[model samples]
Target: MEKFFHFVSQTGFSNIEVSSLVMLVIGLFLLYLGIAKKYEPLLLVPIGFGILLVNFPLSPLMVQPENGQPGGLLYYLYMGIELGIYPPLIFMGVGALTDFSPLISNPKTLLLGAAAQIGIFGTFLSMLMLGFTDLEAASIGIIGGADGPTAIYLSSQMAPHLLGAVSVAAYSYMALVPIIQPPIMRLLTTKDERRIVMEELRETTRRERILFPVIGILVTGLFLPESLPLLGMLMLGNLFRECGVVDRLSKAAQNELNNIVVIFLGLTVGAKCTASHFLTFETILILVFGLVAFAIGTATGVLMGKVMCKATGGKVNPLIGAAGVSAVPMSARVCQAVGQKENPSNFLLMFAMGPNVGGVIGSAIAAGIFLAVL
Candidate 1:
C-alpha cells in the first residue's frame, strides 16, 4: 500500500497545480483550434503540442531540469531560439518564397509599410507608460510588426524571459489577421476608397529583380548595421530566388528547409509557455497590447493609404495599406477580401502584395532600429 501510494503520487495527476491545469486546458484549446479550425496548423499544431508536453509534471521537455536530471529534448530544441538561429532561418525561407515584384513596380507603397510600423513604436511607448522596463517594452513592441520571427528574435535579444508571452501574442495576432484587420479596415476607410482599382503592375526586369536584394542590403546595412543579421539572411534568400541560377537552393530554402525549421521553431516556442512563466498579469497585458499594436498598425497603414489615394488622384486603394503589418500573404489576403466586398470586380490581391512584401521589409527595419536604439 505504501509503495502503491508513492507511485501514484509520482504521476502527473498527483503533482498538478491550478496553474498547470489551466495551461493544459489552454494548450488543448490551441490544439482544437489548430486541428479543427485550421488556424495556422503548421505553427499552432506544433506549438500546441509543445505546450502540452511541457505542462506535464516532471516532463522531460522543459528547461533547467530539476534534481540534476538532464535537460529534455525541448530544452535542447529551445537553444535554436535561445541562440537566435531559427528566426533568421525562417526569414531566409520567407525571402525565398516572397514575390517582391509588386513592391518593385509600385515603390511608393513602401511608405505604407513604413507607416504600419507605427504599431511597433506605439506599443513600445505604451508599454513604457505602463511601467515595463525598456527591454521588455522593446520586446513587446515588435509584436506589432505582426512578424513572428522578428518578434521572437527581438525578444530573445532584449528580454529572454518574456519570450513565451511575446511569441504567443505575436503568432496569435498573426493567425487572427482575418478577424482583426477587417473591422478596423472597414471602420477607417470609405467605401469608395476600398473599391478603387489600380493599374496592373509593370513587368519587373530581371535586372531589377537581381539588383533589389543587393541594393536593399547595402542601403539597409549602411543605415542599421545591427539589423544586418536578420536583413542579410532575408535578402540572401531572395537573391537565391531572383538570381534564376539557384533553383535547387531556392527550392530547398522555401520548401524542405522551411518545413523542417518551422517544426523546431514552433515546438520550441510553445514549450516556453510553462505555466509558471505564462500565467501572469504581465502576460495578460502583453496579449492585450499585442492586439492594440496590430490594430494601430492596420489603422495607420490605411490612413497612409488614404493619403496616397488623394495624392495619386485615386490610383491607390486605401485597403491595401492594411497589408503593411507584415503578416505576409495573410494581411494582403484580408485586403483582397475587404475590397471585393466593396467592389466585386476589384482584384486587390496583387496590388495588396506591394505593401504586403514592403511590410516585411519595414518590420525587419523596425526590429533593426529597435536593436540599434535600445
Candidate 2:
C-alpha cells in the first residue's frame, strides 16, 4: 500500500493543476488546427506538440540542471533561441529560397513593403501608452510585421521575459493570415480595383540578380549595421542562389539546414509556452494587440495598393498590397485567391510577390531600427 501510494503520486494525474489542464487543451486544439485544418502545419504541428510536451506535470523536458542533476533535452535545444541563433539561420534559408526579381523588376513595390512597417511602429506606441516598457512594447509591436523569425529574434533580444507570448502571438497571427487578411483586402478595394491586371514584369538579367545581394549588403552594412545578422544572412543566401557557383551550399541552406533549424526553432518556441510563462494577463494583451497590428498592416497594405492604383492610372490591383506583411508567399497567395474570386482573369501572384518579398526585407529593417535606437 505504501509503494502503491508513492507510485500514484509520481504520475501526471497526481501533479496536474488547472493551469496544466488548460495548457494541454490549448495544445490539442493547436494540433487539430495544424493536422486537420492544415493551417501552417509545418509551424503549428511542432509548436503544438511542444506545448503538450511541456504542460505535463513534473515533466523533465524543460527542467534545468540542479545539484548535479542533468537538465532536460529541450533545455539544451532551446539555447539556440535564447542566444539568438536560429532566427538568423532561418533567414539565411529564406534568402536561399527567395526570388527577389519581382521587387527588383518593380522597385516601386518596395514602398508598399515600407508602408507595412507603420503597423510595427504604430503598435509600439500603443503598447507604450498601455504601460509596457519600451523593450516589451518593441517586442510586442514586432508581431505586427507578421514575420515570425524577425519577431522571435527581436523579442529574444529585447524582451526575453515575454518571448513565449511574443513568439506564439507572432506565429499564430502568421498562421491565421489567410483567414484574417481577405476581409480587409475586400473591404478596402472596389470590384473594379480587384479586377485590374498588372503588366507582366520585365525579365531581370543574371548580372542584376547577382549584383543585388552584394549591393544590398554593402548599403545595409553602412547604414543599419544592427540589421546585418538577419539581413546579412538573407542576402548571403540570395547571393548563393544567384551567383550560380555554389549549388551544394545553396541547396543545403534551402533544404536540409533550413528544415533542421525549423524543427528546433518550432519545438523550442512551443516549449516556452508552459502554463506559467503563457497564462499571464500580459500574454492575453499581447495576443489581442498582435491581431490588431496584423489587421492594420493588411489594411494599410491594401490602401497603399489603392493609392498606387490611382497613381498608375488603374494599372495596379489593390489586392497585392495586402501581401506587404512578411508572411511570405501565403499573404501573396491570399491576394491571388481574393482577386481571382472577383475576376477569374486576374493573376496577381507574381505581381504581389514584389511587395511580399519587400515586406520580408522591410520587417528585418524595422527590427534593426528597434535594436539600433532602443
Candidate 3:
C-alpha cells in the first residue's frame, strides 16, 4: 500500500503546479483550435502535443537524460532547431510547393513585400527602446515577419532563452492572420481602393521560370551569404519544380520532406514552452510587441498598395498589399476576402500571390540582414 502511494506520488499529478496546469490548458486550447477550428492544424497539432508532453512533471520525452537514463525524444529533436536545420528544409518545401510565376509576372509587388518588412525593423527599434538586448530585440522583431520557421530559427540563434515566447507569438499571429489582418487592412484602405480591380498577370515564360531560381540564388546569396542556407535550399527546391525533369523529387519535397520537417519543427518549438521559461513579464512584453509588429506589417503593406495604386494609374489594387505578410496563402486569402466584400468579381488571389511569395523572400532577406549586421 505504501509502495502504491509512493508510485502515485511519483507521477505527474503530484508534481503538477499552477503553471504546469496553465501550460497544459494552453496546449489543450491549441489542440482544440487545430482539431475543431482547423486553424493551422499542421502547426498547432504537433506543437500542442509537445506542450502537453513537456508540461507533465518529469516527462522523459522532453527532459535530458540523468543517472544514465536516455534523454527524451524532444531533447533530441530540439537539436535540429538549435542547429538551424529545420527552417531551411522547411523553406525548401515551401519552394517546392510555391508558384513564383505571379511574382515574375508583376515585379512591382516585390516592393510591397519589401515594404512589409518595415514592421520587422520597426519592432526591433521599439524593443530596443523597451530595454531588450539587441539580440533579443532582433529575435522578437522577427515575429512580425509572420514566418514561424524563420522566427524560430533566428530566436534559436540569437535568443534561445526567449525561443518559446517568440515562436509561439509568431505562429499564433500567423494562425490568426485572418482575424488580425483584415481590420488593420480595412482601417488603412478606402472602399475605392479595395474595389479596384487588377489587370490579369502576364504569363511568365517557361524559360523565365527556369532562370528565376538560379538568378534568385545568385543575387540573394551574393548580397547576403548568411541567407544562403535558407535561400539556396528554397531556390533549389523551386528549381526542382521548374526544371521539368524532377517532378518526382519536387513532389517528394512538397509532401514527404515538408510533412516530416513540420512535425519535428513544431514539436521542438512547442517543447520550448516550458513553464519556467514561458511565464514571465518579459514574455508578455514580447507578445505585445509581436502583435504590434504584425499590425504594422499589415498596415504598411496596405499603405504601400495604395501608393502603387496611384502610381499605376489605378492599375494596382491596394488590397493585395496586405498579403505582404509571410503568412503565405492565408494572407493572400484575406486579401481576396476583403476585396470580394467590396467587389464580388475582384478575384485578387493571383494578384496577391505576387506579394505573398515575395514576402517569404523578403522576410528571409531581413533575417539575413539581422544576422549580418548584428
For candidate 1, report its TM-score: 0.97
TM-score against native, each model: 0.97, 0.98, 0.98
Residue 296 Cα positional deviation in candidate 3, in Å, after optimal superposition:
0.2
58-146 per-residue lDDT for model 3 (tens digits): 77787787999888899999999999999999999999999999999899999999899899999999999999999999999999889
Worst 10 residues of 3 by lDDT: 57-66
lDDT of every model, 2 decimals: 0.92, 0.93, 0.92
Clash count, one per candidate: 0, 0, 0
Residues 232-322, model 2: lDDT tens digits: 9999999999999999999999999999999999899999999999999999999999998888888888899889999999988988888
Model 1 per-residue lDDT tens digits across residues 114-231: 9999999999999999999999998998899999999999999999999999998998899899999999999998887888988888999999998999999999889899888788
After TM-score superposition, what is the CA distance of residue 200 in candidate 3 from its true location, in Å? 0.9
Candidate 3, TM-score vs. the true structure? 0.98
The segments of candidate 1 whose C-alpha lies over 4 angstroms from its true place after superposition are: 65-69
